[model samples]
Target: MLITIENRNYGSFKYKNSTAYVHYRNSVVAEVPIEGELVPARGKINMTTSVDLKAETMISNPNFMADVTSGSLNMTSTASLHGKVSLLKIFKFPATAFSMCNISFFILTKSIDSKCTSKIKL
Candidate 1:
């Protein structure tokens, strides 16, 4: 694995209406939740970015770093997934010039429960 992720950027979730995003390896994954009455409304999970792969040549290929150009991995959440806690696990594999990776986990935030009903992995 031995992969390093820098330029870490993140945002907080709103009480009811909010968005959360995680960006890694030039790609972004997000889970959004709808806002309700805080205690009486229904919450839903929406996908703004589904762990889509975006090549950051600088990281994917060392040659791109030789130019000394600056680049960024940006992720924006459309809505907030408000629960008690959230978790992310990454698995990496060596594949030629590029690395193959996958993410898996369960997030239990405020509205989220331990029943393992709502889950997202990419």
Candidate 2:
């Protein structure tokens, strides 16, 4: 299921990008793209965010579906954050992002693979 562990701004920060992926039995079942572009926030910055990733659409994997239906499925959701939130601008300190989670694609940076094994519209 799609779970948002963190929603409150905690204060404004920025990421090059982020995405969500559904995996079953070590296979990538689908991708949920997080939309945004790089924008410099003003002296003081804030961002409102929510993922469009849907839990209902996570039925593309038959085995997963069967397990889930049978109440024998073992599933977990994880999140990784890699940005500074010490200040509203978050960029006050000089640092580089070392990691993030569920980023399945990218358009600007060549750092991520811009393709997914499969996709289902949500």
Whose TM-score is greatest here? 2
Which consecutive 10 residues in model 1 have the weakest lDDT in total?
A: 1-10
Instruction: Write candidate 2's Cα lDDT for 1-122 as tens digits.
Output: 33223323333334444555445445544454543333233333334455443444445555755665554433322323334333554334422222224433222343433221221111
TM-score of 2: 0.37
lDDT of 1 by residue, 1-122 (tens): 11121111121112334433334433454332334222211232332323333445325654445322333222222222333211222332221111123332222221311111122122
Worst 10 residues of 2 by lDDT: 113-122
- How many clashing pairs per prediction, in order? 12, 0
Which parts of model 1 have CA positions greater than 4 angstroms off?
1-14, 25-27, 31-33, 40-122
Winning candidate number (lDDT):
2
- Between which residue pairs do clashes occur in model 2? none
